[model samples]
Target: MDAASWDERYRGAELVWTAGPNRFVEEELAGLPVGRAVDLGAGEGRNALWLAERGWEVDAVDFSAVALDKAGRLAAERGVGLLRTVCADLTGWSAPEAPYDLALIAYLHLPWPQMAQVLRRAASAVRPGGTLLLVGHDAANLEHGHGGPQDPRVLYTAEQIAELWRPYADVLRAEAVTRPVTDADGSHAAVVVLVRAVRK
Candidate 1:
């Protein structure tokens, strides 16, 4: 979907995504010391706000201005002041002025080539010894996982993520990690593939 579509989607009565941060983000970033961070495609600023609460200065970038506005309100309500929201297309958006201590690209789906370019740019924005983390729907998610984008072209594998960031950063961790998803029927299933790498 384009920016207009996403804007329209977020202009509705409710937030499309949950208020909390992504589970992978919480787990992966829990141990890191707070520093400069960038959240690409930060829908509603969940992860970005969470990071801010933890003392990180966060830049939350998304295409939807309405989403950013809601994110700002959410941040104010939560009493976290470290969030800076930017409305721009990730495909053409410029990187932050300074090198970030951490860069997060969570669940931002795009075509394969564009995804690679975005990942590469995100990785390059990280400072040396910093981290560039990516979490998204696994390619297998469409067939086996519970919820995410249905399009296979935007879904990714651990190998693909590794290759995308290889030129700019060292692969610290690149594998498919699963998390449980609870259903209304009381059954449980796994969803999402988490890929994490640190800048060399």
Candidate 2:
């Protein structure tokens, strides 16, 4: 969805995202040192807020004004004001150059060239010896998963992610993973592609 679509979508009476950070974000970053970080496509700032709570100075970048407003409310409620919210399209944006200890994107899916370029920008934002991570619904999820976008152009595979991120950083791990999910419908699994790397 575009910014206007997301803005309209988030203009709901309720918050669109969950209260806390995404599971993969928490898991992958659990042991990483808290420092300057950026959460690209940080809808509602859940991950950014989480980082702030843990002592990281964070930049929460998203294009949706509605989501940023909700993120502000959430930050206030959680007593967290360490996040900087940037409402910019990532295609034309580059995260600050090599100044961050960590850079991450969660569930931000774009078509191939844009996605690749964004990943490059994300990597460039990371300082040497710092980390970069990306998590998104796996392309294979279309056949086996329950939620997430259905467009293959935006979906990605483990191999595809590895290829994109390799030239920019030293990959710690790259894989298609499965997570258990339970809702009113039933218990099931969702597939995701995860990339963890350190800037070279």
Candidate 3:
């Protein structure tokens, strides 16, 4: 969807996503020391706000201006002065040359080539020994996952993630992870591709 579409989606709602951060984000980054971080495709400031509160100086980038506005407000309200909200296309936006302590690309579902381009850029932004975390809808999610984009072409796999990060970072874990989805009837599984790497 385009920025206008996203803006429309967010304009009506006070919050497009949950107020809390993503579970995977906290799980992976909680113990890490504070430093400069970038949250690419940062929507509604969940992860970026969380990072700022935890003492990380965060650059929150997203194409949606409306979302960025919401993010800025959330930051101010949360007493987090460590965040900078930027509105830009992650695929084309040239990152500042300074390396970051962490680069986070969560749920940015583009076609394969575009996704690779953005992922490479995100990885390059990370300083040596810094962490790069990517989370996306697993290709297998078409069959098993819930609450994700429906297009399979935009979905990704662990192998694709490993291949993308192998040259520049040490691949710690690249795999299809399962999440439990609870419903009125019962609980089921959902798949998501999670890639955690540390720049070499």
Candidate 4:
């Protein structure tokens, strides 16, 4: 979706996503060394706010201005002064040269070369030995799991992400992880691809 579409989605009063960071994000990053971090496609800045609360200087980037505005307001309300929001299209966005200890791309789905392009941009942001973590709905989730984007074009596999990162980083973990979900349709498991790499 474009910025306008996302803006419309975020225009409602209630939060679109959960108020807290993604489960995988908190679990994987809680023990890592805290430093500069960036949350790409940061809808409403949940992960960014969490990082700020934990004392990491965070840049939350998203295309939607409305989402960024909401994030800014929440940061002020919670006194999280370290969170910064950037409104830009990720495909055309570039981070400062090797400035971050960690770069996170969560649930940001795009097709093919665009996905590769964004991944390259994100990888470029991490200093050597810094971490790059990506999480997204797995392609398998469409038929075997539950509740994610229905479009297969945007869904990806763990191996695919790891392969894309091969030139710039060393893969630490790459797998399809299952999480329990309880929606109105009853209990189900959502499969998501999780990949962690360290910049070379």
Give the number of the best model, judged by lDDT: 4
Candidate 3 lDDT by residue in tens digits, 16-120: 888998888899999999999999999899999999999999999999999999999999998999999999987797779889999998889999998899889
- State every prediction's TM-score relative to the real structure: 0.94, 0.96, 0.96, 0.97
**For candidate 1, which ten residues in a row score worst on lDDT?**
185-194
lDDT of 2 by residue, 7-74 (tens): 99999757787888899999999899889999999999889999999999999999998898888888
lDDT score at residue 79, model 3, on the 0-100 scale: 91
Model 4 poorest ten-residue lDDT run: 12-21
Choose 1 or 3, whichever is better by lDDT.
3
For model 2, the local distance difference test gives: 0.89
* Ranked by lDDT, top first: 4, 3, 2, 1
Model 4 lDDT per residue over 1-200, tens place: 88999899999766999889999999999999789999999989999999999999999999999999999999999999999999999999999764899999999999968999999999888999999999999999999999999999999999999998989999999999998899999999999999999999
- Local distance difference test, per candidate? 0.88, 0.89, 0.91, 0.94
Q: How many pairs of residues collide in each model?
A: 0, 0, 0, 0
TM-score: which candidate is best?
Answer: 4
Clashing residue pairs, candidate 1?
Answer: none
Candidate 3 — which pairs collide?
none
Q: What does candidate 4 score on TM?
A: 0.97
